[model samples]
Target: MLFSETELQRVSVVIKGILTPYVAEKIDKNHYRVRTEIKRPGKYLADVFDSDNLIGKINLHVLSETQKKSGGDDFDSMF
Candidate 1:
C-alpha cells in the first residue's frame, strides 16, 4: 500500500537486480494499492514517482517460507 499527498505516476520494485514495474491501482486521489509476486527472500526497494519527480522510497523485506513459519521478527509489532 502506498499513499501520497499528490497522485503517483508509477511504482517499481527492484527485485533480483531487475527493475520491475507493478500495477498501481488508484483507490482514490492519494491512495494506491500495488500487488506483485516475489518468489525469493531478500530485501527490496520500491520507488514511488509522481510525474518526473521521485516522491518516496519504500523498503520491502521478504521472508522465506521457513522463516515465516518460524515467526521471523516481532520487532515490527512493538511500534
Candidate 2:
C-alpha cells in the first residue's frame, strides 16, 4: 500500500507516544529496541527507574491490508 509522507510522520508520532517511559532506539528501518527493568505483572511502578536494563524489542513495519489478514507470512516458506 502507498502512504503519503505526512501520514507516515503521523504514525511515527503515535508510536513514540505509546513507547514512553522505556527508551526506544530505531535499530533498523522499522525495528525498535525497548529496554526496562525485569518485573512481573502488577509490580511495575509509574516512576521507577531500574537502570534502563535490557528488556525486549518491537517491530513497526507497515503492512498491506491483505498482509494483515493473511498473517503476513507469504515468504516464510522460502526460508
Candidate 3:
C-alpha cells in the first residue's frame, strides 16, 4: 500500500540491488496499490514515486516456503 498527498505515478522495487518498475493502480484519491511477483526469498525495498519526486520507501521481507510453514499462518502477528 502506498499513500501520498498527491497522486502516485510510479512504483518500483529494489531486489538484490536492481531497481525494477512495477505496475501501480490508483485505489482512491491518495492511495495506490502495487503488485509484483517475487519468486526469490530475501529482503527488498519498495519505492514509491509521484511524478517527479520519490515519496516513500517500504521495507519488505520475503520468507521461503519452509520458513512460512514453520512461522505458522498468523502472519500479521509476526510483525
- Best candidate (score: lDDT): 1
Q: Candidate 3 deviates by what RMSD? A: 4.8
The deviation in Å at residue 8 for candidate 3 is 3.3
lDDT of 1 at 32: 83
Q: Note the residue pairs that clash in candidate 1.
A: none
Best by TM-score: 1
lDDT of 1 by residue, 1-79 (tens): 6777876566443334556666677888888876668788888876666555666688778778878866855775566
**Of the pair 2 and 3, which is ahead by lDDT?**
3
lDDT of 3: 0.67
Per-residue error for 42 in candidate 2, Å, reads 8.2
TM-score of each: 0.55, 0.26, 0.54
Clashes of each: 0, 0, 0
Compared with the true structure, the alpha-carbon lDDT of candidate 1 equals 0.68
**lDDT of candidate 2 over 1-79, digit per residue (tens):** 1122221111222232344564444454444444544332222222222234323233345444565566856676567
